[model samples]
Target chain A: MSTPYVRRFDSFDRVLHGFLMLSFLGLAATGLPLIFSDQPWARRMTGILGSFEVAGWLHRVCATMLITVFAVHLSRLGRRLIFQRDFGLLWGPRSMVPQPRDLTDAVGHVKWFLGLGARPRFDRYTYWEKFDYWAVFWGMGIIGASGLLLWFPVFFANVVPGWFFNIALLVHGEEALLAVGFIFTMHFFNGHLRPEKFPMDRVIFTGRVSLEELEEERPSEYARLKASGGLAALQVPPPERWLVRLGTVIGTTAVSIGLLLVGFILYAVLT
Target chain B: MRIKHWLAFFSVLFVATLTFVAAKGPTNIPMKAPPAPSRPAVVKAPPEPANDDCLACHGDPDAKSDTGRRIGVDPAKFTESVHGALDLKCVDCHADLKKTTDFPHPSKLAKVNCAGCHQEKVAEYDRSIHAAARRQSAGSVAATCVDCHGTHDIRQKTDPKSLTYPLNLPATCGRCHGDPDVIKQGHIQIGNVSDLYKDSIHGKAVSKSGLMVAANCTSCHGSHDIRKKSDPDSRVFRRNIPNVCGSCHEGIKAQYDNGVHGIANGRGNDKAPVCADCHTAHQIQRADVASWRLDTIRECGTCHADKITTYRDTFHGQVTSLGFVRVAACSDCHGAHDIHGKADPRSTVAPGNIVSTCRKCHPTAGENFAKYDPHADKHDKARNPVLFYAAGFMKWLLLGVFGVFGLHAVLWLPRGFRERRGQAKHS
Candidate 1:
């Protein structure tokens, strides 16, 4: 029999994730050159983009896309809480929110990595996954706000002092560097580069996880679902062949570009 | 007195008037027209010696003077010359031989006086450094008419073959100015300006592009009236530099005239910069060139010492320091030709216009964006406390995060290796 699949993300979530990845990559590709404008490669990259002005335009466009994604994601959470009365999203084993269990999981995972203990069983979201999700909230808060200030300096000047623009520039560039560095390296590793996920983990793109993967990676959630008779409800037929291929193509392209950008950033920093 | 003192006096007065009339001759007649304005009597020029008369012997290729000097003159070349084109005869310049009827004129003829026809030009040349040196009796080998204009083959400057043509002037002047031996012998203080001009934008335009409008050696330095740069009347004198360059760059000159530096220069401030101060006198390249754009910041810094120190601290300055033009240079915001003080509303960097100046490069820039000080001194707490603190905070934040995470990554490497080994063993 074909490997059974369980839905990890809905179509809406998958599409939103796709937009998020694209916009984030676009922002990095355009913004990194400006921050490292002194590098020889930076000029070449800007030249490829037509000019620094064109790159600036592309950066703002991507920033708008990212902000829209952030807003939509927030509205969905708001709708779940207020309109749908879904309290489970805020606090539960299935919730993305961190809990005491996450602390224990992190400790157990480190011990297991050190060969001192058995691996911890994950629920719907692991501690690292929760960290990644929340880091976006933190990153978006800093980078997005400062980016807006920089984008509308004239409008903001009426409210803030002139030196605030200086601060905004500093914060915007530094926070962006931190975000890009983290997302490209640490996040890439956890999402796709770890030995278990070696080449990739396409669940984010295809919106499905194989039954075996669901069982092995999230045993606690699997046990809970099975006990509650929710496991069968979550099960679905395997994803279509073309859907998987699409996911592979998108995933591979993104991973390659992200790694290449990382290479550029490292070279710029080291030199 | 009273025409007739008496009948007896009438006779004597009549004789005296007649005697005066006789002494003045017919010119005193009442009917005679006023004597024509006195003029030197015009004597007809003596008939010029025919070219055939002189060329019979002088035209021979083997013709030589009694002193063994080559006296040969190619008849064909002279016929094609500027003076020949004017149909001048051989005796026109060689006036001493005008009356010589002998088959072989005396070899010792007076030196030809070009001043006879070109009095004004010769007078101008007499006041020049060349003529002054020639007259010094120190026997300085200085250029005269024949040195630049060929003896018999002289062509009009309009002709491309002429040595004084715009394209050929550099090399013609370079013959003496570029010669190391001439420079040393003449004690010329200005060394090899010819080579410097050849590499300049003006030189390249003239020689390589064949642009007739481009300035040649005689353009700034007058052809016959060239003076030392130290002379106040000189075209290249410090005070006259603007007007000299302005003769060609009119629009730039107008803009510069209204600029602070130009105004200061007008007020006789010797320190105020002129075009040559930043661009240099010779070896001037196009301002748009990357090297020139990058280097001009340092040129401006030579005077604005405090401003440059602060500018060097900014991102734009750092990028330029690395020799890139991708970012704004000083002139990008501050006007290049018409730069003004910030207090002046007309200034690009003035409070009212700074946003628009920034918008040149950063199109979306606004008042707040313009507030990002390009020359902010982070160390000057009194002037820029916010920048000082912000920069300090960022420095530590970067160090802190990298220090922490870098250690974590390092620590995790050993475990990663152990895990890989364990997995291999288990497999």
Candidate 2:
């Protein structure tokens, strides 16, 4: 029997995710040592990066890539909205926005988790996915802004108070930590680490989900596609096993690095 | 089969060795015992003079000279001197008198050479700058043995009556150094170094505190072989400063030997400072004192112009400039003696160790806080654009994040509670 699959994301989204992962990892790897420069391990890590000067260079390069990738993503979203006139992509169940149904789905899921009601059947997007998506806009804006301020303090200082520099340092470091912590803990678990998805769900990387996975995770979306006669048009050959394996390696490495960083950060915060 | 046989043989050998080792060890080794003292003591009188008849006329109380100067001598005072104690006669020093048979000498006597008896001291004096200056200028500005120690009344330095004793050294050296005629003639600024020494920390200790081990003139400069600092052989030479000071300041010298400046000096860099450069030869003060520690900043600033300027703009620099003594200075981070480059792991200012160094002033400072460079200038974007942008980004981010997140939290908390209540009703 021919295994069925559906395209969940296009190549552009996968490339964006790749860029983000690489840049985020680059930034964290080169940046944390600077934040905790007095650590012996931090010193060794900086030595590997070729001194604080080299680390600074790596950090600036990664920061530029991160900023560019985020800008490209927003521009793509704009182009979709303005040129493509995909008004539906911005709202409702198909959109990355919260809706009336999403609230019910959230309340229903809570009841299920609490054992008071049945689990809500998610469509194209769940309330958690919406939260995750919306959080990026806020986090990226905050982290990016603070990063810019730190990168051009003298110019900003001429226009603003000196205390702003101190504030920038605090926010940039704290927000970066928050982002790393969340992506490592909440996002990893919800999207990849949970038992149902353990080891991973490779749709984000391969841009395709197995039919069985689609049916199990988003039965409502499957039923809606069937009802609208779009299911047949979306169906394609299942992703190659090697592609899935490649994603496993990428996902596992990314998550492991995240876990390591989170563990160190927790130690710093608690201690 | 051969390996097994060898192992068995080795085991037997090891067992035999263990048995021998367990036996009691011998305590004694063949060594000769030292012999006891055998010399006998005997009562003896002072050596008899070669010519007691010379002292009879010369040591008289009413003796007169051709220049009308009294030549009176005190018998007891003479007996107490080093020469008198040795029972030397006047003719021994004045050898020309032995040639004279008449009461009045036929011709004048040649100048007596102290080297006739004090050969080592005379040799040392010959190598001295004073001796060189005397030969160059052909003048009496050079100090001979009689200049520091009187010819007829010379005493051992151990004696409290000696002019060379620690307590009397300042006065002895200052005699010629304080004289305006000697200063003008020799073209030397003598009073500044020796005369002012009497009012310094060492002088005060020697004069008032009765500190027996206090440094004196001869402590830094050799008495017999005193030379200008420009001479490498001089005790006060710049290259020999650490050793000269180290004789007394052993601990500071040990610290300096491991320091960057000391390491540089060891590599033959003449630019590096030695003891006398920072702390003057004569007027050194207690380094621990607040006023004196403040002076060290200016001294360090002399060589590190750019660093001092940046440091002055820092919080520590501002506080120090305002006369606050407790603030951290260059020596506080880069240690006073054990200073090294930031790349050196042992360096106090190295990235890995900077936190502890900072904690000296900021007790609770963490690695994060230490990341804030005290000498960094936010006004120079060309050097540090990241810090500049970070500051601006944080300012606007704080305002936007607070405005948005603050509103979100304010609305969400009450909404969350309402949603829970609604869920309860539905359930």
Q: Which has the greatest TM-score?
A: 1
Writing each residue's lDDT as its tens digit, candidate 1 over B1-427 gives 2332243234434444554567656543222221211111122344335667688789886788879999999888887888776545577678788777776887788987777767777888887878877888567878888778878888888889899988998889999988998888788887888789899999999989999999898888888878778878778888788998999999999999999989988888989888898788877899888888877888999898988877765557755655567788888888888999989999998899988888887777666567678777767788888877877887787677566545545545566666657667977
Error of 1 at A210 (Å): 3.4
lDDT of each: 0.80, 0.72
The runs of at least 3 residues in candidate 2 whose Cα sits more than 4 Å from the true structure, single-residue gaps closed, are A1-271, B1-52, B55-57, B60-64, B104-108, B378-383, B386-427
Residue-level lDDT tens digits of model 2 in B212-244: 688888888979999998898999888888888
**Candidate that would win on DockQ:** 1
**Which consecutive 10 residues in model 1 chain B have the weakest lDDT in total?**
B32-41
Q: Residue A20 deviation, candidate 1, in Å?
A: 1.3
**Could you list the iRMS of every candidate?**
4.0, 13.7
Candidate 1 chain A TM-score vs. reference chain A: 0.98
DockQ, model 1, C-alpha based: 0.23
Q: Second chain only: TM-score per model?
A: 0.76, 0.75
Encode model 1's per-residue lDDT on A191-237: one tens digit a residue.
88766676778888788998887887899998999899998988888
